[model samples]
Target: LDRRSTFAAEVCGCQVEIGAAGAMGAAAVVEAAGGTALQACDAAATVFQNIMGSVCDLVQGIVEIPCHSRNAALASMAFLCADM
Candidate 1:
């Protein structure tokens, strides 16, 4: 929940869950799955950095157009980050 992310959401607020909030949840999942705290944090930070932007403009009131792809990509990425 940094200003840049908040601003990105405010500027193009569509799927709030698919953004920083999603990454935060991903981190907790990593930690719960026996990942180290640092790993969890790294996963979350990397996810946040990867998807961080006012890119919610792609979510034009639907899930088919890039939203689903973004979610899948990030969800998969969280595990990779944890492993790394």
Candidate 2:
């Protein structure tokens, strides 16, 4: 139970940190591109949605199955979002 709790905390922390960083980066890009507040926020929303955590409990509870692909997907999504 403690391990699960710790995992949950780590997941929550990543969500907050990555989401905020992406949002801020999106906003900055939008501003630099001469976009309005609404546009910036919309871009940030797209980023946030894309960067949300992926499922990490696949393959009969085997840890590696989910860890690699899930984290890779998250990183790719973040890059794609930033490019958008």
Q: Please tell me which predicted candidate would have the highest lDDT against the true structure.
A: 1
lDDT of each: 0.67, 0.60
Clashes of each: 0, 0
Error of 2 at 20 (Å): 1.1
- Candidate 1 Cα misplacement greater than 4 A, ranges: 2-10, 13-16, 54-64
Error of 1 at 38 (Å): 2.6
User: Residue 27's C-alpha lDDT in candidate 2?
Assistant: 70
Q: Roughly what TM-score does model 1 have, to 2 decimal places?
A: 0.61
* Residue-level error in angstroms, candidate 1, position 63: 6.9
Can you give the lDDT of residue 67 in candidate 1?
A: 66
**TM-score of each model, paired residue for residue:** 0.61, 0.53
Model 2, residue 36: distance off in Å is 0.4
Candidate 1 local lDDT, 22-55, one digit each (tens): 5776687788889888878888887767776636
Q: After superposing candidate 2, which stretches have Cα over 4 Å from the reference?
A: 1-11, 55-84
At residue 23, what lDDT does model 2 achieve? 65
